[model samples]
Structures are given as structure tokens and as C-alpha cells.
Target chain A: MNIKPLGDRVVIKKIEVEEKTKGGIVLPNSAKEQPQMAEVLAVGPAIANDEKRKDEIKVGDKVIFSKYAGTEVKLDGEEYTILKLNDILAVVE
Target chain B: MNIKPLGDRVVIKKIEVEEKTKGGIVLPNSAKEQPQMAEVLAVGPAIANDEKRKDEIKVGDKVIFSKYAGTEVKLDGEEYTILKLNDILAVVE
Candidate 1:
């Protein structure tokens, strides 16, 4: 099932990093490194201010989020995170 | 100078993890682990959601944050990240 967050929360599908090094060395799960990127699946409506402002991100945007930004959730056999709009560092176009 | 975020940004002081192991083993910087903790330093005003609601965190609180949630900015003699409030997972009282 798809889990969507309410309010300013966002749902992001994590991009898995390669388990092998450039030199063809294999890495264990414990040794796996965190990636600096992710794909945006959904964003919550802007946290209501005086008015609802448009959020800077949209669906399918590839983004760079802080290394520590969203709550983790497992969905549809994959892992995803629900982050607040502020947790997003930069939208990678 | 402190780099306070202008909007829903929060300033966090990274908690340096121990470079040693249970057996007194030494870990290199490259082999260093990311800590699941940080201390809150400052928080920006709520992004005007109709009215400013009180934030869930405050200064000096130790917190658990998403492993990928903020922008890294080096201020003064230390490194800190400015995350959106949503990036914060749970505060350690």
C-alpha cells in the first residue's frame, strides 16, 4: 500500500546504492553507505500559513535531502521516507 | 557566525561519534559511523501555517533525526546542519 503523509510531510522513494565498489569489491549491508539522493514520490500540501503557498517540490523530482531528513516506512516491498518539506536540501531538477 | 535558517530551518550541532570500538579498536575517519543523535541549537519561526504553531522541539534537546534530512553548513569551528522541522524524528527528553 502507498503511504502518504498528512500536512507538510512528504513521501520519498529511496534510491538504492550499488553494493559493489567501483573496483568491483563487494560491500556488506552493514558496510553499505548512505546515498545523497532520492526520488520524490509525493509531497504534503504546504503547511498552512496565512494562505496555502505552493511547495517547491513536485512528484518525480530527484532530490538531495539531508543525510538525516525523513521518517522511514516500508511500503509495497520497498523502503520510503516521509519528510517535511524543510528536510529536503535541494531539488535536483 | 551562526547560520540560522531564515524559514522553517533548524540548526543542529552534530554529535561526534566515538572513533573507537568495544574492544578499544580504532576506526578511521572514513570508517567512522554516523550518529543517530544531535543537540538542537536553534529553530526558525514556523512557516506561517495560518498562524505560528509551537514547534515540537526546542534548544538543547537531544534528538533523533532522519539519516538524510538537512543541508550541511560549517559555522565557526564546527559543522552543523540546518534541517526542516519535519526532518526531526523524535526528541530525547
Candidate 2:
């Protein structure tokens, strides 16, 4: 699906968490904190500046995002969200 | 206290949640979701771009952030974190 964000928003796909615990025990979904990780799929036009410069984030970068930043939806068998670029917590190197 | 962030990082003071619920029920620390909100205290020099542009966030902007984004520290009786600007979830209006 071609997902695009408006303004400084970004579209992200949540990265699923592993089902196993550190000690090798299988964990139920309810036992884990929702993983705050994502894969960037699209970014909006950068916030404009007085100098008419535009900065943009690239697609396909792995990012760490807040657990609650955007409205969530499932499209084409995948989950995605439209969030502000500033809502992204950090870009994972 | 004076705090400065390195690179795209920002220094934020965690906003304290109300100890009581809107229904007038007192809530213990353990019973509430950790408030993922902060007040921006300082911002780092903006990341450099090929265009030599630096976009900086201003001080005193109340922001909503993730529950876990940066290393926590206490400076002069206040708790703060040095988090990358990308870690900020959204600039709360």
C-alpha cells in the first residue's frame, strides 16, 4: 500500500516483539511491554523554515518510536500508523 | 540548573502526574501508567545537513515523549534526560 503522511507526519510499521523471554520461557502477549520499535515506510514534507529549506527523513530506516504516537491501522495485512516525524523517539542505527 | 544536549539530543524535565484521579480517587505511584510527558528544558545544536541548515527546537516547549528514550539523571534536585530530538514523540500544543 502506498501510505503517505500529511505535514511532518510519518508512516511506520510496528516491529513485532519476540515471544520468548530472556530465560528461554515462552511469553504470552499480555506479559510483554509493547515494543516501541518501528520501520519507517514514508515521511511527510519536512517542517518548513523561514529560509525555504526542507529536511526529510528517508524511507526504510529503522526507528524507535513512542508506544503511543499515532493512530494505528492495518492495511494490506500489515499494521501502520501516521505519526509526526517528531513523534519518532530515535532512529536506530 | 543549566542543561545542554549533545547533537540532536534534548534535555527534558519529566512532568509530574496528578496524584489523584479526576474522580477524586488518590492513586498510588504503582497504579498509574508512567506519564510519558515532559517539558523541554534545552535543545542541542541541530544536526548538520549538506545545506548547512540547523533547525533547533526552542526551550520551554511542553512535549509528549516515550516512557523510555534516554538515560535518566538528576541535576540540582530535578530529574532530566538527554534524549535525541528524534525521540520526542510530539510537540504538545
Candidate 3:
């Protein structure tokens, strides 16, 4: 990919949710809000401070981030978001 | 003021825009957008990783943050926002 995030920023590809949950329950459109999970595509280089960029998150890691955390951008006709590392709430283990 | 953010989150009190500018020009209502400046009221405790919480930001620091970076909340009829430290772009100094 041509995109490279800089300074604590991360590029994320949103994960598509299936129509049915893992238990085989079909979700109605209203109940299926945008998924808060995404796969990390790229992470920025280290930032100015020692605190913000320990680089714990890596590419290919599936993470859950805050619902309203990123800026939407289009890449190669695919939608992605650019978020700061701190916006990532949890790493899905 | 009573709200305390958790896990790299920060509480911010937005700075209001005055009708008059510093150069003595009165800005019309349309000219004034929401100010992205705020005072840091509180910061959350550190997160799981050493990466996310070097804690460069501190309470009472004046900062500039992303325009859409936080969740608006009402506290005792006062407005505030809870943001991650990464949402804070720069210190006003």
C-alpha cells in the first residue's frame, strides 16, 4: 500500500460484520451498527515523546478501537481509517 | 469537572470563542466555528502497555485537539469532552 501513517497514527481497515452472529442469530439492519473492530494495516513511526510510541500495536493485529475515533479515508477504492495509537481500546487476543 | 477519564482518556473543557477578535474585529456568527482549543481537566490512568501512556499531557495544560476527537458530555450543566491523549495534537504553551 502507498499509505504510510506518521507519528503515532495508524491506518486501519474496517472488518466487515457478517449478517449472523457466531451463534447463528441473524441481526436486523438496525441492530447491525458499524463494527468497531479493525485490522491494523500500518503504524506510524515513533513520535516526539517516549510515551506515545512504544509500538506495541503491529500490522495484522486485530484491534478494537473507540467507536468514534478515526478519520475516514479511501485507499485503492477501499475504505480505511487513520487513528492514533491511543484510539485503539483493546487488542483482541 | 467531576468527570475523570480512564485508561489514556482525558477530560477537556473547551475554550469559548468571543465575538470580538484579538485585532478588534467582530466576527459574525457564521465566521465562528467551534474552537479546537481546550484546557485539560484530567487525564486517565495509564493503559495496559508502556506504549500508550508516557503521559506527556497534564491537567491544566492548554492544548489543541482534533476537531472531532472526543465524546461530548454534560457534567452538572457544564459541557466537557473525554478524549484520548493522542487526540491532543499540540500544547498551546
Candidate 4:
């Protein structure tokens, strides 16, 4: 990807929601809700340094973000959401 | 009026969507899209300190947030959304 987020923005790759349960009942696409979680791919320089900002999030973190948040953009044929640092709700443990 | 969000969370009071334009064509409540913006009221302790977190938001700042981002709750008969710092998209200039 040729995009680098500026300031405290980040690039997130969506994580797919489950299509089935433990009982093995398959679910249609409409039956599933989009996952509100994503993996952090690239983080901006403003948040990468502890001196500039309290860096709680990092690349490769499995994070939960707000639904309907961030602007979606296509990069190299893959979809990504560009979000400010505050758009991420939590860092999943 | 009596809510305080925890961690990186914040309390947002919704800014109602414009029901009419200057041309005076009034819009019904159903016709208006929910405004994706709000005013910052109460901020969490974790986000108040610069050493703890870089505070980009403050009380009374007009902010734009994701419409479906935060958890909604009723406080004192008014609706408010409690959101993490990341859920806030930007502070309006």
C-alpha cells in the first residue's frame, strides 16, 4: 500500500464476522452483522511516539472500533478504513 | 447531566439536525438524518492528562463523531452517548 496516514490517523483492515455457530447452522450474509473489529495495519507518526501522544495502540493490535466510523477507501484492490486515533474504541486483549 | 464516562470515554450531548433550511422548507423529524455531531460535555479522567493521553478534545468543543459509534444511554431524561476518545472524529474549528 502506498498510503501513510497523517497525524493520529490509522489504517484498519476489517475482520470478517462469523457465518456459523458451534451447532453448525450456516448463516446467510444478510443474517450476519459486520464485525466492529479490525487489525491495525499502519499508524501515523504522531501516535507512534510516546512523547507526542500516549501510545496505547500499535500495529498488529486487534482493536475494536465504532461501527459506522471512519471513511472507507480502496487501496491496491483491498478495502481499508482511514480513522483518527479516537475512532478506535478499545484494544482487544 | 449526571453521567461520567470512564477510561478514554466521554459524554456527548447530541446536536439535533437542522429541521429547516434558510429557504423555510421545514422538515419533519423523520425526514432528517441523525446528525453525526455533538458537543463534548464530560471527559474521562484517563483522557484529561497530557502525560496519560494527548487531549485533543475538551468540554464545550463542537465535535463530529460517528453516528452509530458510541453506546447510548438516558440521563436525566436526555439521551447521551458515551464514547471512547477514538470515536470522536474531529473537533470543529
lDDT on C-alpha atoms for all candidate structures? 0.70, 0.68, 0.74, 0.76
**Model 1 CA deviation exceeding 4 Å by range:** A47-55, B1-93
* Cα error of candidate 3 at position B89, Å: 0.8
lDDT (tens digit, per residue) of candidate 4 on A1-93: 345554488888999876786789988766778779899988865687647555688889999998978777543467777798888999998
Instruction: State the TM-score of the second chain for every model.
Output: 0.80, 0.77, 0.78, 0.83
- Alpha-carbon interface RMSD for all candidates, in angstroms: 7.3, 9.0, 9.2, 7.9
Error of 2 at A31 (Å): 3.1
TM-score of 4: 0.51
Displacement of residue B20 (Cα, Å) in model 2 is 33
Model 3 misplaced stretches (Cα beyond 4 Å):
A1-45, A48-93, B21-31, B47-52
What local lDDT score does residue B40 receive in model 1, on the 0 to 100 scale? 86
| Candidate 4 error regions (>4 Å) | A1-7, A10-69, A72-93, B21-24, B50-54
Give fnat for candidate 1.
Answer: 0.04
Task: Output the better candidate (3/4) by lDDT.
Answer: 4
Model 2 spans with C-alpha error above 4 angstroms: A46-56, B1-8, B11-93
lDDT agreement of model 3 with the native: 0.74
Candidate 1's C-alpha lDDT?
Answer: 0.70
Alpha carbon deviation, residue A7, candidate 1 (Å): 1.0
Q: Candidate 1 at residue B82, lDDT?
A: 76
lDDT of 3 by residue, A50-76 (tens): 454555677898999999787765434
